[model samples]
Target: FFFVACETHRARAMQDRYVLVLVGVIIITFLTFHQEICKAPFMPHLTDPEPPPLPPMLMQSKRQLLPDMDAEAPPATDVPSPTDPAPQLPPDPPPTGALLPLGPSLLLYKPTTAPMWDPTFVPRWQHLVSIPIMRSRHSMRLLDLCITSILYMTPYPKFDVLIMLDPPSRALIRKSFLEGRLEALNAQYLMVPDPIYVDDFYTGKYWWVDWPMLTQYKKVLYIDNDVLINADLNDMFDAYDMEGGGHIYAAQEGEFWRMWKSTPMFGLTWYKKTDYDRMNAKGIQSFNAGILMFVPDQIFVTNILEMRKWMLKWMEREIPHFTDQSFVNHWFNTRLLSKSILHKIQLFPEHRSYPGKILLHWCASFGTPASVKYDKMSSYLTTFIEPRLPKRYASRDAMVAGLLRPQMVIAEVGCFTGNFSQVLLETQPKELHLIDWFKGQGSGSDADGGTVVKLPGDQALQMLQDRFASSPQVNIHRNNSLHALAALQDRSLDAVYLDGDRGYDWLMQDMLLASAKVKPGGWIMGHDFYTYDRVTNKKAEKSLNPDVEKTVNAFLQASGLKIYAVGLDKQTSFAIRLMHPVFWFK
Candidate 1:
């Protein structure tokens, strides 16, 4: 009975122990499930990531509001339905000053604000003139001056210049006169065949024999390179077209029949001594072939095809001094006799002949040395021609003279009336480029505080050309400032003066381009840098440009450059010196 009682006790004890173990296991499982699934607020776990640290206060986007569920819904048409696609807004524009990546390592900043230059712009020209350039240096110089005079003084802008030359002469002109590029002069070249070598004058004059070959043009005016056209030649051309019926009209030689007296007439089988007597008695004389208006088609029947044959067969030899003048005079005289007319055929009236009432011809071969004639021409250009034109404004140019030194390569980007350019010239720069669109200006305050009258662009252009035409150092570019600035080679200028477009973008572009073009240690300068009031930074009376100061400061800051100097003139000017090599932003 005692053993059975003990076994019963042991079994009961074992069951109680199993029940405790089962209860403990159930509690552990409940805790694990609660922690994993419920994640209670009060319960902390090792795996739970700390709530993401609050975002930066300023960077955090505003919280979008959810529609209130309890609020009364608006009319269906008032708001878009929840299922409808969201409205789209345009993406914002990219920043203006974003750095343009140059390469893997380098980045540059170029302005995207300014309008790019038009690369396709070309002036359409109408009138054309043929200017014959000789192989000699003296003649080339004369040609240059002649071109300058015609461009500046003619008062007409439609004329296109054509250079008549042979291969050797063309090469010579290209090397010496054109600096190895014919396009520099903006002229076309016409090749002459088997050019005559003359000691006295250029053989280009003889090209009249081949005028018929120039089938492209109906009428052509021939002017010597030594002549400076002071007035319009259109009237002369018009007169010839109206009065000269398929014939030539020319200025008479200074000495009338005396020039043709020694010519051989015996070679003309159809001519008689009486014809010569009648011609001399009637005051009939050969015209100076230097300047002629001729119909190219009229001479097609006479010696037009064979160049060498005409010279050998018809040339008068009694006066051994041979020239195109003698040949044309002899040839045309015979043509005139066939038509039974003497003075009426070729001679222009006395008013247009000899002393040249309209234009000046420096008959260089007539007893004067070519060098002497050139000097005289230069003197006449500066002293006589320049003084005759009006000075549009009071002098503000003297102030800039102090900034420039002799023989510097200088460019004035916006020269008006050449007032500042005159001072630049006085400094004797090796080359001075005067650039302007010459698009006219309204009445404005002058340097002396007087109101100047309105000026037209054409008149302004004419004035600028007249004022500077005599100066070999002055080169005028009638173009947009952007176009002109871009045409310059980078790092080629010693200094660039900007008084061009005053708009913020334009000023910035000009400054940037000028900075790029200037050599290291060179200056970039501009006008109207400050207001007349000098303080308040506002556009004061007489201060035409309000954006100059801001644009200049911005450019200086960007380029890491500083203002070197400022002018003391009433209309203030500023200058920047580039100390180091510039790596211009894109």
Candidate 2:
């Protein structure tokens, strides 16, 4: 019985130990689960540090973090958050590949902004303004005085002035006019030191310095210091805007036309750099550096520099005409693109105007000192020093006469006075067609003492009536000679004289009219045929009018008109119809 009780106590003690170990294991497992739950929210901190406050996105785009969920999600149309790596877009199919090849590495990037330029883009027109440039030396008092007079006398309101001068001279100009009484005008003075390397007259270097100011303004009016701006330039400035960009605009240099054939190298010549060098190698004339409008751009600036260099070289080589203006004309004619900008500013007519003028130059071609003195004395002594007379004739008479002539008729092609017309009126015909492109009121009465019948109908007809009034027997029809000739029966007119000195075009028109109207043995005469003016001598290379030699020769050959007699003193040449040709049938 003692052995049995000892065995039972050992068994009970072993069973109690097993139960305590199981309870300790269960408590440890519960503590581990509670710690894991507390650390769940902190898992984000262990990852990237707040993921760099998502980059700024474009406004007006609805972005969503969770696209599928209804409550937390943005609208269905919302664009995906750019921060959330965008889905890889399909690769652009290679030109040679049949389909887009699968690739392990593919990245998609969205454009941030639209392209700067596009093929379909249209440009808007911009309003442009221009300033005239007047550059002068301090020593040229005549230029300064004239310019100052022009500024004061102009009827228009103040316009922008870009004055380029020596520093001291610039200051003096500003003090005298810009800052003083004439400050009301918008004027900017640019001071530039006289170039040490280039002589002023030879290289026209001063003009190059003024280019910077010209570029700043849309259009630049370049006037010589000797110019007299009698009229308001608002019309000229308004005309500039009509010239589109990348063009060189200029006033119709009437003087240039008169001398163009002689100096084929006169005026602005535009050229690409490569071509300019080629031209220089060939020793061709490029551009005219005198009064001109240049567009400030890379090509232009480069061309100007190249041109100046060439001119300097020419000066070094002892070219006869050392003037920069001459070089400029040479360059433009030789190198500039055919499509380059050329507009004729016809304020001044070369035939009448002096050396430099916007409107009318009193004495352009003064010969020897003695001749100049005589002209000056004559001008001063003349009773009619009136500016109004010339203006009236030029503006009203010239324009009116041009309008009245027939479409095919050639009216006064040259300057004709009343006395000259009366000489023709001595042999009166049934009907007289007097065409004067520029006809003024009669200064002297006709020899016949007949009252002048100044018609006020079509300008062309009025011109004829006014001209033939000396012969009361002749009925006058003032209209375009072309239109008048068209109405008349073939070979009906007794005489036709095309004396207008406009240009070759007018001369040709006159030939056409004379050929049609004149009967057998009818007389035809033209003025200014033999007269050689000195103004034409200086600018022979850039003359506007064709060489009278060539014009007369060509017309004589083409029209088959026989030369009757050359005038004794004047530049007049007369011709007569030998036989009326059957041109109408042809």
Candidate 3:
């Protein structure tokens, strides 16, 4: 019975062993399959949604989820939207052109190639930019004398006048003119503190004007109050013709240049701060404060201030010959390297005047009365003297004689007197448009006293009314010709006459505007064609027969308007118009 029991136990142990072996084999097989599946490369399942939720069948089968540790997932195939921020692009290269170095030290050369021509060219070649280095003592008499000389001598009607005055001289009046005359000329004035010459340095009460003038005009022909200008300055503007150059063109000391060619005073010298320093070190040149054109940049201004301080410190040491003038000449000689720029320096020849083309400088030695009485001075003053007042064109006689014909509308510009309108009235024109600035009242009034109707609150309207109050038939417009022309309807007038301000720019502006108002083939006439030489004072030797030559030439060149007839009245030359030529008028 014991043998049989032991055999039964052995049998039971064998059965248990068999079952354990079988289970181990099955587990190994499942793990091997899972390892194989995880190691396999993945193919994108584009058609499936949510990646099949991690395979529930594998979890139920008791398989390992990831047996292999080496493989990577495939990269994404779809790109991001273009609207997303992109990487920055590289910058473009710079353009290729000729380059130039700038500063006062460098001498610039004009290029051989011709400069592009500009129609509105003013000769700035010889133009002098003056800066007055004023001391405390204001020189009002000198200032007046210089200003009067400028006014009398300048040939051009307009100038950019800069007056740097001391703060104290703000209320002082430089010009003695009637109230009406002052308004006619548009002049700009400014006042600032003088840096070089302070108020406490000198007790001369007259120094206030000098300080003011120096402070106001940065780039000017700073004339000492005692000096006089007696030449036409148009040549000065010609200096701008130089292709490439620097600032501070000056006149040479003729006497000095004649003595020594290689000497520092060979010609007018231009010096900046560096040049000034070099000159002081080498003892070459000095500064001149007399009639000069100052190039007013920050560097130059600072240098000027420094130079002024140096001068004051050495005032006791240096025996003053010409005061600042000799110093200036010395400064130019020491600093300026190349004498090529000095080619423009024109000296006052012994027989000929200094600034023969532009100005005459009458120093203090001449005395005020003698200076004023000089032949050049007399001639200068006579140029601006107004001629005898012109006689009025008789309105009734003109109309009766068929000099004036009835038209759809009569347009008269620059109606100094309403004589033309008066003539138009006799012909009973349907409309009369009179345009003028009317500088003089009653100067252009007609016999009938029917001129422009002045309206209140109209800036332009008031001007026309004040000037043309005598002419009842004429309707006055105070606005600029360009503005008036823009307001008019097409073919609004039958006849148009223009005689406003005399300037190429002004004439052109008026002509462009008037062309729009006149009907096709309508009459257009102008005045002052024959008065150029008379107006410019260029007719001393030549006869004053500029009526057709000057004005008509300019008018034709400007507007291509043909001259129909030259009506020879007693004093005035009147131009009648032909039909607007198709080729030329436009």
Candidate 4:
């Protein structure tokens, strides 16, 4: 046993020495070979073992020099140590024939001058979202000096006007915005410190003509707010020549001969007289920048930025009457024409000053004196445009609509002329009782004869009877509402609406009976649930009856029923039975 143990210890020590020698050899070898192993560079994996030698199709003929494919092999430049970053090279060009968009599609607005408006009295119109519709004495041209122009522009649903505001103007317009004068127009706010061209020569007037790059719509339709499209512009979208890499869509300012000058600043008759003559002989017209559909290229954006620079250089020379428009004329007619390219600016001929065209360019209509009546334009808007605008429900109408349910019994008290009752009947309810005596003495003064007091009771009933004759659901009771409800069974009604005479006794009498007649889970409501204060008097231009408000409050307070304002104007108020947990919690 002692001899075996001694042999085992000696063998173990020998094995340990052999392992250490083997490890030392491996360490030395790895140190020598590590650099070469990592020297294999990273390249994007493609199926091909080598990159294709041919240049991209677009680059083949146009580009003067193409990047060498062989140079794509990983360079054996300075070997990066552990702490060193990988060597940087210019990024690989986009894949062959891969077209990248210039930028996102956007709608832009520039409010250079504030509009003249009274925001509060303006009605909330659902058709015109996010557009300020305050009572404006200023012509649309003045209001559209920035953002207001879009109010009468194309009725495109996707038009959420991107109002480009400098930081300082935001605060000044904050109140008008909060008041929701612009809610109908769908206004979006963007803060630009200033325009791209901040030079003195570029007045804020038509600078928004460059809205394409400013709002970042690679392809854009820039219509001045004053210009309204008589037809949908969707058909016109495909009409644009997007296949051509460079294109500009605009109307000719006037005849090229009329705008031509001895210098390049005009229609470039002097700078590129030969090219102008050539295109002119081919029948191309000089164009306007006002209404345009164009792709914003680096070429155009560069031209815009260089306008100030170029003008400064040529200041010892002439400046044209129209600033940005002339610059754009020079860009297409001269710059692109000289390159033997198709000048690509397809001007809309026979359509420029053609009033009967798709676009109704109420040309040069802005900033005119208020006394200068646009009676013809008003007729056009009223007859052609206003009739075409989408009709929307008023807040009061929508409130009445929400409460109505089919297969329910309801009563409308003091339903003179049944104007509001029309909204309720839309639900096709099982039965609706309309109550009004249709007889009240009129003092001839508007204060007493306001609406119901002067209405002929017998004729009003005839109208209601005829209006609802097709609807078997409506039942008219030509009597005072209080006496009318006595005939109705207790807990028989699902809802009761009291919009009767404004006298305290009349309102209270009707409300008390309506509350009792409505089922335990039913709705009880009234219209004009507001005090006749100075605000109301001033708005109505006469004294309003306060009895409607007083009677409603008293009845609801005494009955311990919580009333909810149904419309934004607080003209309608309603309360349901105290059965729902929502009412209890409130």
lDDT (0 to 1) per candidate: 0.53, 0.39, 0.40, 0.47
TM-score of each: 0.43, 0.32, 0.36, 0.36
Tens digits of per-residue lDDT, candidate 4, 429-505, equal 79989888877532112112234335566777777788989888889997777679978996688778777677887
- On lDDT, who's better, 1 or 3? 1
| Per-residue lDDT value at 415 in model 2 | 22
Better of 1 and 2 by TM-score: 1
Error of 1 at 549 (Å): 17
Quantify how close model 4 is to the true structure by its C-alpha RMSD in Å: 23.2
Model 2 TM-score, all chains together: 0.32
Q: Please, what are the lDDT tens digits per residue for candidate 2 over residues 367-482?
A: 22223333442342222222321111112222223212222222233223344444444333344455443334322222121243443234534454566566555434444555
Model 2 / residue 182 / CA error / Å? 6.0
Off by over 4 Å in 4: 1-156, 165-183, 190-218, 233-246, 262-269, 281-283, 311-320, 337-358, 365-379, 389-586
Candidate 1 similarity to native, TM-score = 0.43
For model 1, residues 1-586, the per-residue Cα lDDT tens digits are: 3544555567577876765555567667878997766542221101124322222331322221112222343331321112334323212225552222212222222223422222333423433466665555566677666665543343323444557754556665655424212332245565553222232132345454443234345555667766665544444444443233435556555433444344432122222455456555655556665566554454442433332233332221112324555555545554452122212222322212222244566663433445665676666655654443321212236435544566678898878687767767887889898888877562324443346556787888888899988888888998988889899898788788887778899889888888778765567888877654436433366555668888998887876655655664456677676644444665
Q: How far does residue 496 in candidate 3 sit from its true spot (Å)?
A: 16
Higher TM-score: candidate 1 or 3? 1
Q: What is every candidate's alpha-carbon RMSD to the true fold? A: 38.2, 33.1, 33.6, 23.2
Residue range 365-412, candidate 3, lDDT tens digits? 211343343444445333422111111243224422333355457777
